[model samples]
Target: MAIIKLSVTERRRLSAFFTCLVLAFAAWIITVLSNPKPYVVKEVLEFRNTPQKRAFRPLQSDTVNVTINGTGWDMLFSKMNSAYKAITIDLHTLESKSYVVLSSQKDQINSKRESDQQIIAFNPDTLYFDFSNRKEKRVPVHLISAVRYQRQFFQSGPVTLNPAYVIINGPASVIDKITSWNTDTLKLDSIDESVVTRINMQPVKEGNLSLYPKNIQASIPVDEFTEKVLEIPVRVLNGRNIGEVKIFPQKVKVTFTTSLSRYAEVDEDFFEATADLDLWKKNGYKTLPVVFSKIPDYCHIIKIEPRNIDFIVKE
Candidate 1:
C-alpha cells in the first residue's frame, strides 16, 4: 500500500485555516452573552388548589407585569411567540389567609421563558385577596310572567315549579344574604292551555357566588273558567251634614268569572260595592256609578247588575 502525505508548507496552511474558523465561532458566542436586553410582558393570574370551603376574591388586580432579561441571540432563536400566559398560584398554602406577598418564590409564578431569558421582576410585588367562608342555603324561586289569558280561561292555582327552591352554595357573605331568586321574564299571550318551559335563574353577576341548577322547570296550571253571578250588598258612606242618602237598590248582583278550583272561593263577602255620598254633596248627581273594590285576583269582573245607582238625599 502506498501512503500520500502533504508537504510541510501545505500542512501549516491547513492548520491556520482551522484555527481561524474556531476563533470566529468563539467570538460570536462571547458577544451574544455579553449584552442582555430587557422586555416587558403581561400575563393573567391563575389560582390553583383553591380551598373547597373558601373562596378567594381579587381585591386588587387580576393581571401582573413581567420584566424579562435575555441575550440578543436567545430572543431571536427561542420561541417568544407565546400568545397566552398565566401565573398559577397555589391556595393550599394560603389556608384562610386574606392576602399574600408574591415574588417571594420564583416557582410560584410560572410562565414560558424563551432560551436564556429570565424573569427580572414583576409589577405587582404583592397580591391581595378577600377570603370568605363558604355556605349552602335553600331559597325559594319566583316566576315573572307576562301572561294574557283567553276570554274564558284563568289560572287554577299558584304556578307550580319543578323545584320549589334552589340549593345555592357560595360565600357566606353572599349566600346568607339571599332570600329568594327570580326567573327571567317570560311572555305569553292568549294562553288557553297549560304552559311548561325551562327558565334560567337570575345570575349572581357580582361577588364570589355560585347558583345550583342554573335552570329550572316552570309549569303554569291553566284551565277553562265559567261566569258566575253573585248578589253583593252596597254601602253608602262619607255623608257628613249631607243628610241621609237613600240608594234605590240596597244590593247589587256582581258577576265575575273564575276558574273551577277557585269558583267556591268567590262570594259576595269577598267584594265591596259602595256609592260615595260625597259625590251628591259636591255636584248633586242623582245617578252615580257604584265603585267596586276588594276584587279577588283569581276572579275577573264580568259586569255589574246596575253600574249606576239612583240616590235621593232626605234632608
Candidate 2:
C-alpha cells in the first residue's frame, strides 16, 4: 500500500463536497416520498338487503375500477397494510324487475368504503343491476367420491354424509329446474382403510343459485373383504307347489362375496331363492330362471350354479 498525505484545507474541501452530496440526496428522496401519486385499482362490491326468499342475478360486475390518489409512502403502506371492505349496495327498498343506477347511488357506495384512500373517479362512471326474485327449494346433497381399494378391501357400507341435504335457493324459474345438488368430486386411490374428512360443495353459478351448507363431513367405511359362498336351497313355488310336482334338483349352490363384517350375517335366512309357479305356468317352459329375493345390502352375488331346475308333474 502506498501512503499519501493531503493538506488540512484540501481535506476540509473534500469533506464538505461529500456532505453537500449527502444533503442533496436526502432532499431529493424526501421530495419523492412526499409527493402524492394516483393508482388505478379495482374494488369489490357486496350486495345486501335482499329478501330471504329471493335471490338476485348479478347482471353487472361486482367490482368497480377506480383511480385512488395518495402519497407514495402512504400508498405503499396502505397497499401493504390496508384492509378494504366490499362496497355494499342495498337492494331492500328497490323494487324487483327494475334497473337501479349505481352512479346515482355513488355516495351510498362511498359511504360503505372504510379505506382512507381517496377514490378520484370510477372508470365506467356508471353501474346498473336488474334485480329479480329467486326460487327456492330443498334438494338432496349427493356426495361423489371415487375410491379404490388396496387389495381385498372394500367399502363395508354406504358412504355417509353429515349433512345429506342442502337448501338450494335461487331464481324461482331456475330453482324449479334444480332437483339435486352435487358435491365436489373426491378421489381415493388404493384406499386401505376407512376415512372421514370435511369436503366442500361445488359452487353452483348457474342461475345465481346458492347452497346453504357449502361443506359437509364425508365418511367412507372400508374393511378387508373375503369371498363367501352360501349354499341357498331352491324352493319350487306357485303352480309347482299346487300340483304334485317333483323338481330334479332341490338345492342350489350360491356363491357370493361380501365384507368381513357381514360375512357371518349372510346365510339362508337373509335371502330367498324361488322358482315362480306363475312364470312356469305362463311360459310352460321345462326350466325356469331362479329369482333371488330380498338380498342383503353390501352382498354381491357372484355365481348361481344350476340356475334352472327341470320339473315334471307326478301322476
Candidate 3:
C-alpha cells in the first residue's frame, strides 16, 4: 500500500469547490419551489344556501379533488398539511335543478379564497342530489357524560338543559329514524360542586341532516351526601280476609344516603315498607320478606334491620 498526502492549499481548494456545489443545489431548489404551477388537493365540500323547501342527499361522497393554480410552495404546503379548509358550494340553484356544475361557480368559489391561489377546476365536476319530502321535528337532547365524584359527593338531581329539545330538518326517511340528538361527551373528574356550561352537540354525519342551535346549556346539580336512618313500620299486604296479622318485628330501621339539602326533609313518610302475607299462605314460606313500596327519588337504600319477619295470622 502507498500513502499519499495532499498539500494544505490543495485541500482548501477542494473544500471550496464542494461548498459552491452544495450552494448551487440549494439555490436551484429554492427557485423551483418559488415558481407557479398547478397542483391537485383533496377538499371537503360544504354546502350553503340550501333550499328551505326541499330536502336533498348527495349521491356521491362529500369530498372532491380540487385543482389549485398557485406557487410551488403553496403546493408543497398544502400537501404537508392534512387539514385543508372545506370548499363552500352554493345550493341555491338546486331549487330548479337536481344537479350542480362546479365550473359554473368557479368565480364565486374563488372569491372566498386567497387571491393568489385560484381554484382551477375540481374532479366530479358535476354533483348530483336525490330529493325527498322535507320534514321538520322536535327531538329531545340526550347528554353523554363520564364523571367521577369525590368521596361522599354525587349528582343530587336530574341534569337539566336550557333547550330540552332541538329542531331537526332533513329528508323524511332520515328524520323518521332519528328520535333524539346527543351532546358531545362531558368528562369530569373529582367533581364536588354543581356544573354549568355550554356543550356542543354531536355533529351530524349525514350531509343532508341539519340541526338548529348546535350547542345547548347544561346545568348539573351536585351535593354532598350523608347517611340517614329511619324506623318505618311494616304494613301487612294481601291479608285482607286474614283479619288480624301480627309480626314479630313491627318496625325496621332503614339506612340510606341522601343529599344534605334533603336529609332533614326526608323521613318515614318518604318511604313505605310492607310484608306480604301471600308468601306464607301460597308460597308456603314460614317468614315474610319485607319490601319497599315507595322511596324518595335519588335516595339509595343501604340496609334494612329486619329483611324477613316472622308473622302469624289469626283467622
Point out the higher-scoring one by TM-score: 1 or 2.
2
Using alpha carbons, what is the TM-score of model 2?
0.63
lDDT of 3 by residue, 60-87 (tens): 9999999988988999898899996798
For all predicted structures, in order, the TM-scores are 0.52, 0.63, 0.84
lDDT of 1: 0.77
Better-scoring candidate (TM-score), 2 or 3: 3
Clashing pairs in 2: 134-171, 134-172, 135-170, 135-171, 135-172
For candidate 2, lDDT tens digit of each residue in 103-189?
666676666554556566776665544455766688888887787889888888888988888888777777887777888988879
Candidate 2: worst 10 consecutive residues by lDDT? 93-102
Superposition TM-score, candidate 3 onto the true structure: 0.84
**Once model 1 is optimally superposed onto the true structure by TM-score, how far is the C-alpha of residue 31 displaced, in angstroms?**
30
Q: Candidate 3's C-alpha lDDT?
A: 0.92
Per-residue lDDT for 33-125 in model 1, tens only?
A: 567867666767766565667765778767788776776655554446666466766656567577656676565453554445567788887
Candidates by TM-score, descending order: 3, 2, 1
How many clashing residue pairs, candidate 2? Answer: 5
Quote the positional error of residue 300 for candidate 3 in Å. 2.6
Which candidate gets the maximum TM-score versus the true structure?
Answer: 3
